[model samples]
Target chain A: MTLEEVRHLLDAEVLSGHEYMKKEVSKAFSCDLMSDALTSVEDRTLLLTGLVNPHTVRTAEMLDISGVVFVRGKVPDEDTIKLAKENGIVIMITKYTLYVSSGILYSNGLEGASILHN
Target chain B: MITIKLKYQVEKDDFMKAGQASSNLKKVLKQLGINSKIVRKIAIATYEAEMNIIIHSEGGSIDASIDPEKVKIIVRDRGPGIKDIELAMKAGYSTASQKVRELGFGAGMGLPNIKRCCDEFAIRSSFGEYTELSITIYHSGNNTEEGGE
Candidate 1:
């Protein structure tokens, strides 16, 4: 789904990269642990996370994630928002908890990124 | 035969600046026209190594060299080194403090994640003294598969 659709599905407010809403993201990965996110090999996916920090943006930058959705009504600080903007990562905020948010997106046809098998 | 070398000093306990070196490296790799897949791998490896220094070391430096064929990153730190290389290499072993864990890291996947993102990975350390990590990723643009431990 395109980021614009994601924003609508979650009732999310765009915090950064407002210009890139037309970008399409097919997969989604939801995790609070940055390490777990790093280990997953998924590109152009959307990251649904509860962790609000600069490193979240860094992780998105490294993995080439298309966008980030901060769930549970978490609002990132200015520095975090600025970093996301600098990295060209679109950021959005929603009131739905992480679990519910993931479910909503999944039910809307967003697939999960395949995990690397051991 | 262009070789670009970049260096950055990582400050201990400085979570705010933890990923700067890796971020810079990623930008440079993109500008150099390396494959996006290869660039992401290099970025993840370098960022993991860089965070290891910032979270565990007294201080350190990250040195990255981009050549036509491969990208190499060397992260060296002066601090408490790993006591068990084998144990530390495990996917879920970590010595990071609670404060570090609060930052959404320290899940013990750092080293393993770095290894997974690189073509070659090596580490050396002296307990309570220093640690060094070397990660290399080829630029052939076809080796982006997730590595098996």
Candidate 2:
């Protein structure tokens, strides 16, 4: 599904990259550990994590993620949002827990992110 | 035989700009036609090492050399050096200050992560003298540098 559909399904707030929401995303990864993430997700998949720090954006930058979905209603500060904007990454925030978010995306046709290659 | 050198003046113990050097090194490696996997490996390894310098030491600079077969990375800092290299290499062993822990890193995975990525790794730290890290990544021959920063 496209990022727009994911955003709509989760009632997410767009913090940046409004123009790129229509981009297609095949899978999603939910993790707070950036190191695990670096070696884990292989491609430009959607990142569903609650890290809420600039390193989240930086980690996505290194992995070339399609977008970031912050779980548990966490919102990025101005610096974090600015960093996301600078990297041209789509950002979404949801009130759902990580498990719930993963299940929702999984049931909605978003696959696990490991299959995508970096 | 293309080589690029980008210099960044890192401040002493400033965590905000810690990733700048590694990100730039990644950019340059991409432009140098390095493959994405190798580039990512080099980026992660060098970035973590550089962050250690910024978070634990007074600060340091990174020097990268690109060739057709390999990428060599060197990070050096003139600060309070590591007191125990053996202990430091153990995962979850950290000498990071309270400020470093607040950033979600410095959980003692820095050197181990670096070791996991590079083909060749060397570290030397003198007590109250300095710390320096050298890492090299050999091209796995995929040949496409396409990826994000």
Candidate 3:
């Protein structure tokens, strides 16, 4: 699914990388723990996280993840937003919780990123 | 043989600048025309090592030596080192503080993730003095197969 559709599905607000709304990201990973999230190797996966911090963006940057959705109405501080912009990662905010956001995206035909652990 | 050497200082508890070293190293590898898959592997391993220093040690440095065939990342830190290497290597084991956990790390996956990403991984620690990690990833051939064009 394109990030634009994700935005529409969740009524999310794009805080950065507005131009990337059309970027297709069919796989998503939802996690607050950066290390667990890093276990996945999928590229172009959208991260749905409640952790709003610079490390989140750093994790995405290292893994080549292109987009992040902040769940549970979480909003990142200025530094986090700046880092995401610097790394060219699109950031969005959604009022839904992480589970709901994941469910919404999953039911909409988006798949979960394949994880390395059992 | 052409080689590129890069060094970066990692400060303790410096959450704001924690990823700078790995980020710079990743850029340099990309500019050097390393394969994207290999670069991704190097970036993830280096970043985890860099973050481990920031979140766990007093301070440290990460050194990268890149040649045509492989890249080697050496991470060394002043410590308060790990007392139990076996337990520390466990995937869900972490000694990070609550504050660190709140930062979205500390799920204890750093070292394991690094090992998983690299072709060769070695670690040494002096318990009270310091810890060091050597990570290597090949660009093409396996570890045993060596030749030159």
Most lDDT-accurate candidate: 3
Model 1 residue A40 CA deviation (Å) reads 1.9
The better-scoring model by DockQ among 2 and 3 is 3
Q: Give candidate 2's whole-model lDDT.
A: 0.79
- Per-residue CA lDDT of model 1 for B80-101, tens digit only, reads 9999999999889999889888
True contacts kept of 2: 0.11
Instruction: Place model 1 in a CAPRI quality band.
Output: medium
DockQ per model, Cα = 0.60, 0.31, 0.51
Model 1 misplaced stretches (Cα beyond 4 Å): B141-149
lDDT of 3 by residue, B1-149 (tens): 48989999999999889889999998887777666767778988998898899999999999999887889989999989889998999999999999999988899998988899998999999999999999999985432312210
Best-performing candidate as measured by DockQ: 1
Candidate 3 or 1, higher lDDT:
3
* lDDT for A71 (candidate 1): 97
Q: Give the alpha carbon lDDT tens digit for every residue of B1-149 in model 2.
A: 55555666666777667677878887777766777777777888877877777777787778777777788888888899989999988877888776666566766777887887788999999999899888988984757755543
- RMSD of candidate 2 to the true fold? 3.3
- Evaluating just chain A, the predictions reach TM-scores of 0.97, 0.93, 0.97
Runs in model 2 lying further than 4 Å from the true structure = A24-27, A107-118, B145-149
Ranking under TM-score, best-scoring first?
Answer: 1, 3, 2
Steric clash pairs (candidate 3): none
TM-score of each: 0.95, 0.86, 0.94
